[model samples]
Target: MKRAALVPEFTVPSPERLPDMWPGREVELDGLKAYVRDTPAAAPGAEPAVYVHGLGGSSTNWTDLAGVLAGRLDGQAIDLPGFGYSDPARSYSLAAMASHIVRWVEHSGRGPVHLFGNSMGGAAVVVAAALRPDLVRSLTLISPAMPFLDPRRSLQGPIVPLLLLPNAAKLAARRMSSMEPEALASMVIESCYADPTRYPEQRRLEAIEEARRRHLVPWYAEAYVGSLRGLVSSFLRAYLPGEGSMWKMAARIKAPTLVIAGRQDRLVDIRTAPQVARLIPDSRLMMLEGVGHVAQMEVPRTVARAVFGMLDELQEDKAGRAATQQVATQVRDGVRQRAPRVRMAS
Candidate 1:
């Protein structure tokens, strides 16, 4: 049974600055440079969580939420190969990305982690959990992109899924390359948040700076388009047998899962979250009324509360199992001590 939600004892953070978030450090995962969240003083044996970001998002997306959960979870948000500061690999398929993360979790010996993701990364984690259930202990998805399942909204730029076609995708990539980071970031904010103006000025400025940094990378646009294609491709394979599908994979997950979606989310349809929650056997779905795409970033305190609640449930369940095992052991020991001794004919 799920435990009562914890009342997180903290104020909701204003928009965060880069320096305030965990610094980026290079790490090797899948033989590629995987930039990850670096926290020098994370508590030992705290529940380890691996955070993944969406299309056009980097590990930096977890800045606020990770900080809030730091007391309870030792979090490492990864820059997925080709996005954020990570180097790109040849393959950009959803399965390939998920496999890379699976490798990272196993190689780093951080398995059975609480897997947290947003947008495209959210979909990737779902695939990872399905592929390597041993690696994921729980899943928390924020506006996971169900590309095939998501309908195109006008506020978002030209339908990118169809843009994935050869000529169109190339044209889209070129256009994005020419666009300024400020413009790009502003566009993202308008599309992502229900009320972008509601975001703090300092945070908005930091995001603009982040966009500028992203523009400096020659392959940034390529990475964004590749992620969009990967998401679309994954959506196409959802019901196919033996193929990696998020919906199909969700059914196979054995861990406790929490899915949070913003009622005003414009990217992946808000309707998708409920079905996702329904698919995962032991999952909880929480919808924030006035929130948008990035719930973890926009409402860290509330999101942290949900995470703590999941942790509470996990702890209780673990204790119960341990008690059962101890009782069984005791009963076996008592039977052995009290049993009558019979000598067999020699």
Candidate 2:
């Protein structure tokens, strides 16, 4: 396949530029307001991409990954409604989250973008891609919280029962509220990373600060609980035969996709990664050793390389098609020119 000269291949050097977390601000679009942070690309005419965080995560979760890929992709990471700095929405279901992503892409006119998601955010983008294929160019899922029929084996098992309780989110929120910010941050780091020590001290401080700020939000509990319940419901529907199944939705995705799984992910099962890759027609899988649920955070450079490789291949595919079409046109033109002109006797 011919390689396109449209852009030079992107590479990340050791100690790649890790800029401070991109400045964030509230942005309202299509009547939905979200806290968005933009990471500008150094590469000219770099394609645009959007990052969606998992449950309980904010846009800041993508800081390091986006930073390393800045030369290749201009990135925007949004705070899903009810998480981060975004205000609560009427619903925190998967469908609602997917719709918000679609609306944002439509309103911004950044269609056919490279869409990324992690954990619950991963599930949301799958729906978004299936719903509006024209709006998505490619997909990258890192430890996506796909449907797990049995949560009993994972860290999520304990939280599953909350779905049955009355105002469970509210109740959990009250408990979480009393915990110190540092403690909450520690708990999160422990759960999300294979090696909590790898977590940068600066980011840890940021996480602690976010925990403190979240306590002030009236809807924090509602958002967390609502989103979790919605995720579990999707899991049930995915196994039953129907259009609601996440597996079916994944199979319907038209964009090229890359699924990354951490071997030590305590939240999402690594076994499901293969199933997800097989279901998506144009997809590849990467399983990282000794990595946890958040590979993007644990190994940003590695993830960036895989992402850039996909883009490079996509460019080559386009070039190959163009070359083939050109040759066919030329052959047809040559044959026409060589053939004797035909005319009726006058």
TM accuracy, model 2: 0.94
Candidate 1 residues lying further than 4 Å off, grouped into runs, are 1-19, 40-44, 147-150, 153-157, 161-164, 239-242, 341-346
Q: Per-residue lDDT tens digits of candidate 2, residues 197-305? A: 9898888888999999888888998998899999998989998988999999999999999999889998998888778888998988888888999888988878887
Compute the lDDT for candidate 2.
0.88
What is the C-alpha lDDT profile of model 1 across 135-165, one tens digit per residue?
8889988887754453554244356546546
Model 1: lDDT to the true structure: 0.78
TM-score, model 1 to reference: 0.89
Q: What are the models' TM-scores?
A: 0.89, 0.94
> How many clashes (backbone N, Cα, C below 3 Å) per candidate?
0, 1
* Candidate closest to the true structure, highest TM-score: 2
